[model samples]
Target: MATGADRTAFGPMVIVAADQHEARPLIDDPWARRLLPASGRLAAALTKYRPIRRALIAPTEKKIPGLWASMLCRKRYVDDALRAALDEGGIEAVVILGAGFDTRACRLPALAKIPVYEVDLPANIDRKRTALTKALGRVPANLTQVPVDFNTENLADALARHGYLPGRTFFVWEAVTQYLTEDGVRRTFDFLATAAAGSRLVFTFVRKDFLDGTRLYGAEAAYTEFVRKRPLWRFGLAPDRVEAFLAEYGWHEREQAGPEEFTARYLRPAGRDLPVSEIERSVLAEFTG
Candidate 1:
């Protein structure tokens, strides 16, 4: 049985899928197309896992709105850019923070040659293992599942135990900072900074203004309502402040992608008009330690 803590930790997978399902159609990037099937599968699994959540978990009757939001949100660009960066850096190992039913390890052939580490709660790891076992016959050899509670376990120590070298690693943390407190986010970044000298981190953060209660209610009322019931609410950070925050710890920003630019490069060609409501309006940042 999953403990209460474990349940809370793993529950976000369902929520993320619910969020993606609600925003996928508007996303015109090839990466979104790759993710849609996995997202849809996970959404269905979540609904089957809990009958009560089925109705709420289902995709909205209209799909275009969701796609519109995804394109505007630019998460797909963040993911793609991170992968490209890792490839360019000749990174041999990849760590995915808070991975939730994400199928990149299995689907991305270029990544098949590299070792992929997925860090999440034990329950989620177990669920992923079971699901992948049934779907793929077995977990891929290049993929390593590391289970840990970020609140209690030291990330550096956990990664060390799992054979992650302090040097020569790339970390991908997407759409998770908003769920962490300011202090928690700082601590995690601090840990990564000290973990390895040449390590790189790819992460995203929502702009603080976007999370203001009044603005959230006015612009993303539905999402605001959905997140309100969760223990972890969105906590946005200012884009300008991000550089200063990292500079203090000897980390340097290498590249950045905003929502609008991301959509233009990855989705606009698909002829989609992204809605403001579904967009994440976040900055995707890459930093080197």
Candidate 2:
């Protein structure tokens, strides 16, 4: 319910919070509840009850359809990918690009022993620090907060100044690409291209048609709010082009997943059949060089 860049940070935390209330949640993020604003915390608390969940949460999920599932599914997907990469053994560090209120550094045990750098806007970084402090008493020692404005700053330089080294790293860019322009996305990719071979990248992107209003994917309300009204989203990529796009940047696409893939892989297993928004998709790519 925030505005501007900060809105992205808040919205996902709320979704995480709501997801936590599920009986068999695909993701576990109790810290999400603690890190929310008062209003968000109230919503999280109210939805804990069965009646409120059916009356309030169910209606919203119905209206938005796959919106909630999409967010949760992508989160689970990234988490699984990160864990598998860690298991394969070669990643030197983890960098969370455009990290908002993401608690992965604190929540995931796999990251507990490795160096983790969280890069984001200064304002979001500050808020994240405060929220983490309040929610967990202290920020985890393994995690370093690196503040950078992607529009005007050099990501590589920022990471270097923060002690990030050139090595095989796992980068998680979640729910952030749509807010950046094409040049911005390329700039980040240019930096990623410099990473050592075998480095992994997991990110989420919206469909190009959705951004240009050529397609709505049955979520007109989301388009009206995020596209036309506020005009916060700035870029999108077609699913078919994802492979070539990653190849152009020296990244080899490993997997590209959307609603159907998510429902089959994550939702149905938990005895849930929630629809996921078709407007978005996630990809796992590895540095080829």
Candidate 3:
């Protein structure tokens, strides 16, 4: 989240997303794979010399897996599934907020014909653009990068500047809300609330209990250690209160799934068991008014 020292954690998150750790990856992002640092590419490439990915990365990843990377895999599973369903159900545009190194616009074939707007801070956009151009020569035509600092610019204003339509849409706000202030979170929800009817929003949040000292998931110590020097999680809504929270913004909650739910609904069905069970949770909401 900072400019330099510890930096945006997107790089490591992308490394795990691009890794073929699972037999069938929840998300496939070549841009992530291609943009990796030399050492990361070497390690990631070494894993998949076709089949060695599972064997080599397994042992080392167990020692220190990427924080929230597995959770992202689960979140992406539900989010992408919801996206595909909504795409067929008639959403016209896809907007990805805080989309750092996310490759859904390029990777999901269903989105081939849909316009994708990716919003992020200018510096992060520069890094993403540089790596993308270096790896693939040019960014994709269907994808538009909108650079804005969330603290200063409104999400609605940024998208409107780039010709975003207030029509049927699917908004993906992955792993971003926890980084914002409570007021910022409300501002975003307010925007989503007014999106054309039938538009849906998919976003992730940390459990409020995690912040208030009720860690049920057994991974707390390691998670605590991980965030010691990093940007701390800023805001959260209790899982049980998400419905009431959404109601305040004129949206109706459709589904809220945690790692356990994701495991049962996605990973188990795929017969894929991640090294560490993820802890983050996601809520899917639909505009009601």
After superposing candidate 1, which stretches have Cα over 4 Å from the reference? 1-68, 71-75, 195-198, 220-231, 276-288
For every model shown, what is its TM-score relative to the native structure?
A: 0.73, 0.95, 0.84
Clashing residue pairs in candidate 1 (N, C-alpha, C atoms within 3 angstroms): 25-67, 26-67, 26-68, 27-67
lDDT of 2 at 286: 94
> Residue 83 CA error for candidate 2 (Å)?
0.5
Candidate 1 lDDT tens digits, 108-158: 777888889998878778877877777678888999889876655678888
Candidate 3 C-alpha error for residue 124, in Å: 1.4
Q: Between candidates 1 and 2, name the one with more favorable lDDT.
A: 2
lDDT of the candidates, in the order given: 0.59, 0.87, 0.69
TM-score, cand. 3 vs. native: 0.84
**Model 3 lDDT per residue over 1-289, tens place:** 3533224535454445445555766555555667655665677666665456555545435533433345545556555656665656888888888887776776677787888898887877887788778877888888889987665568898889998988888888877776777887888887888788888888888666665556635555534643444445667778889999989988888988775666676566777665444346787788888
Supply the TM-score for candidate 1.
0.73
Counted clashes in each candidate structure = 4, 0, 1
* lDDT order of candidates, top first: 2, 3, 1
